[model samples]
Target: GIGDTIRVSLTEEPEFEIPVAKIIANRYNNRKQKHGIKAIEKNPLHPFEYSKRASKEVVGIGGKNAPIVVEHDFYFENTATDKLRITELAKWKTDADGFPLFTFTDFAKADKISTQANFVLMNLSDFDTNWQDVLAKSQNIVLVFESKTEHSMAEHRRMFIELINNDIDLPVIIKKRYSAISEEVFQIYAAADLGALFVDGLGDGIWIEHDEQISQQRMINTALGILQAARSRITKTDYISCPSCGRTLYNIQETTARIREKTGHLVGLKIGIMGCIVNGPGEMADADYGYVGAGFNKINLYKGKEVMLKGVPEENAVERLIDLIREHGDWVEPN
Candidate 1:
């Protein structure tokens, strides 16, 4: 019985139930299906991993991990004149008969360059073969998420659940790409017990950030931060927040942002934001601590409270929330 893994938004914070299984890409399966080779015609014990997706394959010895003889491998080359350095590097290496073989990244723009070099020309589908391109196999998955819009979350979850309920027997693990070093991609990775995840650039994405210029140092540091984080623990605070609703009387967005900005350095604190008192407390039941917007313009601080605190100016909500968090408890390290 594979348990389902889900990407939950702290903003929406909706609870879902299902079993998770991670998906593994099978290179050996590619060899068998694409090249018509038996997974092991010659050998009996080759330590092959099998695809859990197909039931027919599961009945016996041949499947996804069976070693397939690879006819080609890709080498990347950047062909612009600015990439003269690449040519310089390739000059040191040679193909069969001691002739230099060049590589290219922009294969789409490689009409003239393809003629000039000895290279394997391939379509995008070649590298992206299903059950082949991925690095490893596992049944369970995790998804990294920041706040997604409400309708987006629902539709996304529904689509994902449908994908999960597919006939694939293998556990499929899902994870979000480009989580912050401050966020808990690693924790989620460990919690979901993932075998591998997609490595990526920082801050949602480099392209997601504005194309505006900044200091080289800042760019390098952020990039390094992302790279280092993909391989290390999240050394800062983990934050969760809610996107605001019309029921929101307070500045939910601003409040959530300030909490993230201020406490982001504090590791493993569980804070929550709810829009209105009607469903806020019930919805935020799993939160360690929370603030809900109450009717009559008051705020309900869920620090074991029965009555609510009167509304302060919206401008001061973040400050007051910070003060409240600091006053409520000290930060604890995640084990």
Candidate 2:
């Protein structure tokens, strides 16, 4: 079953480990659920599935097509040069390579912006109706926010409510500024602040800033992780592996790691790794494929809940799993 929250911890340094975590966290982004046996099919116009709020299209950002990834930095100092930089950067494909850069303090510095600038992000605290007139002339504008603390989910919610009440339909990007903290603490902060907004269909993107002690890549991975958890995007493969216990038949930790190495490149695939029948097929509610330990040194493979192979040798399990994915036409060779 998909849990409300998830955290990935490792013995290696964050820089080395974040890539692996991201490989799993972003698996469900942009993925559509295939219809299975069901008593009723879903209506195309389900209220929760559609939003009346206006979708804004920025260069390289197609709005509701896919959530944009925003990055903040001290890219430009002079207002005159900022305009030139925007043009040069876009020409260089900097904005098109999945991340578009914005200056954190540019709003206070520049009265007018270049047409090449795709998004202007201002803190919710500084946001006012007067600026709306200025932004109305702009192309892409996003509301940037920083909540009070880890328990300040309501604070974030209020900001969005205020925006909607004012009829402001600009996309929002939640920004989290943090000091050196434990991965567990960061995960909680991200899930509560950014994850909550994405789940509510509020935020269209995320920007995470941290002290020099933290890796920038780690922040990007966490942002992607939050978006993935909210089901707003799907960029990588997801795993639904159970914790090992007394019912296990083989070395689950070793087996899971091996399985991940082989099939992790298949984006949007959900692979379940279970210890035994105690939490096998029935437990993997969202897994598209499953590997369950059937007995001592033996495994049962499933395509969803249906058993596909039984009592296969543990040595050949990973290969068999790949074969199953290939048979289902989900396999893609890694470049």
Candidate 3:
């Protein structure tokens, strides 16, 4: 059903390619029901976020997040007569009263624009203007940030702020398309109060590809990480368990996995597992419960040397950990 195509070769060469699709026609059941570029996306067992959504309209694959009940888009136009090219906002037009003239129709949206423009577009032709109209019509305008071909994005962002303080109707934000060196861009967008940030990094080419590994993971992690930072600031417990080393005298993997599996549902209780005694306790300093190999064929677990259980197979480790927590009433979340 995905019969979309894109012209691969520009000019007269006439090379065209089929657009990539999920290919499994019957795969998605809960997709946003609407077709075209704007579709409600789902991720299963994944907790991170993306770039494209710019607005959140569906819940993340992780059950922990709230549904993205709302979403929006930002559209820009090049209204300059000759399409001068400037990368800084300082070069844009100014009124007789010295008021800066930039493109965003809403001050809230203007704040979202970055103070710098690392990316550039040649004079956007009539066709480009129509394209912007298409995006605006197809997607709701949460904000609009304007730029002529000739202004530096950096200067534009500063001008946007200047406009806002000068009593402008704020768009949700103003931002340059996105660039490698725009930390200020991030700050402005974060301050815009957009509903959710869904990133579609696949479109950014060389700039994103240069740090593919990070760009790929960073998008989701950073969005969710903000929530994590807030959670950790006042949270109770965390756990870390290493895979069994070659020198592990006991079934450390099975034990660690089971322990984590059993206690994962518990909140505010830190647990650590070590394969050997050398670093087991030290490495688990933050844990309220710890299990480690005391010697060959000898294993030990203690709630502060209380010896909840010992000499158990890895399969039974989770049960033991659970029992220990129950015995001490440590598994309950603080009210």
Candidate 4:
């Protein structure tokens, strides 16, 4: 469940964080999935598959590229050791290269930014002459925005529109902060706040800031998952699952989880798990493959719009789906 971006935090020496971050980033980067318009030419509606979006290229950020992940925060005092540390880390495309070294600075301190800085996090309320001058001067630096408005989506959208209208093409990453809540609520908020921008092709990347009670790994997973749900990035296997109904022949939730447990490693794969034939095939046609309920404890497997197997026993449905996936060379051994 890793991606090209990562942030490592440690209570120990900063050097200790490097190996941990590098190991995870390298493991995922090695399997780096190239996502772009060509990747989702067939059915762009499938959220798990790459979808078409009009996004500008942000070097090491967006545009058919994997979503970049970052650690919580990086504070800099502009010391020689800090410079040495940033140099030692933050190298793009390498094992230790995923964390976007972010430092929060006002216009006054922006000039003292170490060369090791990859992104500068700033608030929109602070946008002034000095900020514009900073943005104008640094053409290559990526800027991440934090909004003070309650309606962050609209605020972020307005900010983006302002930037575009002003001819500021600097790559922008959307920063969102969330309080610890139920996973379901967090997911909903994330989709509306961050997913909307990604869908409209407005953001180069996303950073989710959450309460300390929420684990960092969960935050990373949720960040990547939001990108996947928007059809902006593909990291893990996608599940186009349906809410069960009266016609449902099997437990949609359990079946979907079971299938995901097995095939989740097959990155970019879309698996549709529907409760019945009513809206199952028609709705999930965008998926690469489907598992729809027939009746009387039976299931029907499909490849796109075409049914591949019929009347398979309910117990055998998941295995059959895996077999079908393997038959198509999409299966990978779970690690």
Candidate No. with top TM-score = 4
What is each predicted model's overall lDDT from 0 to 1? Answer: 0.36, 0.64, 0.37, 0.66
- Candidate 3 yields a Cα-based lDDT of 0.37
lDDT string, candidate 2, 38-132, tens digits: 12233222335634334565543335645655444522122222311223234334344322334435543445444544455444454443565
Per-residue lDDT tens digits for candidate 1, residues 1-335, read 33233333344323321111111112122233332211322322112432222211211111332111111121111221211111322443432221122222332222323222232212222223442222112222111112122122222233223333443332211212223322222223222221122131111111111122433344333432442334322334544355555788876766677767766666545566778877777666666567778754566675533323456555555667666666767553334
What global local distance difference test value does model 4 have? 0.66
The top-ranked prediction according to lDDT is: 4
Q: Report, for all candidates in order, the number of backbone clashes.
A: 30, 7, 49, 2
Clashing pairs in 2: 26-236, 27-236, 28-234, 29-233, 29-234, 30-233, 30-234
Q: State the lDDT of candidate 3 residue by residue for 73-119, as single tens digits.
A: 11122221222122233433232221223332222234333332312
RMSD from true fold, candidate 3:
19.7
Considering TM-score, which of the candidate structures 2 and 3 is the better prediction for this target?
Answer: 2
Question: How well is each residue in 99-187 modelled by candidate 4, as lDDT tens digits?
Answer: 34444444234443333335666665545435666655444566677764446675676666656656666667788887745554565
Residue 11 error for model 4, in Å?
40
Tell me the TM-score of model 1.
0.33
**Candidates sorted on lDDT, descending:** 4, 2, 3, 1
- Greater TM-score among 3 and 4 belongs to 4
> TM-score, each model?
0.33, 0.69, 0.34, 0.70
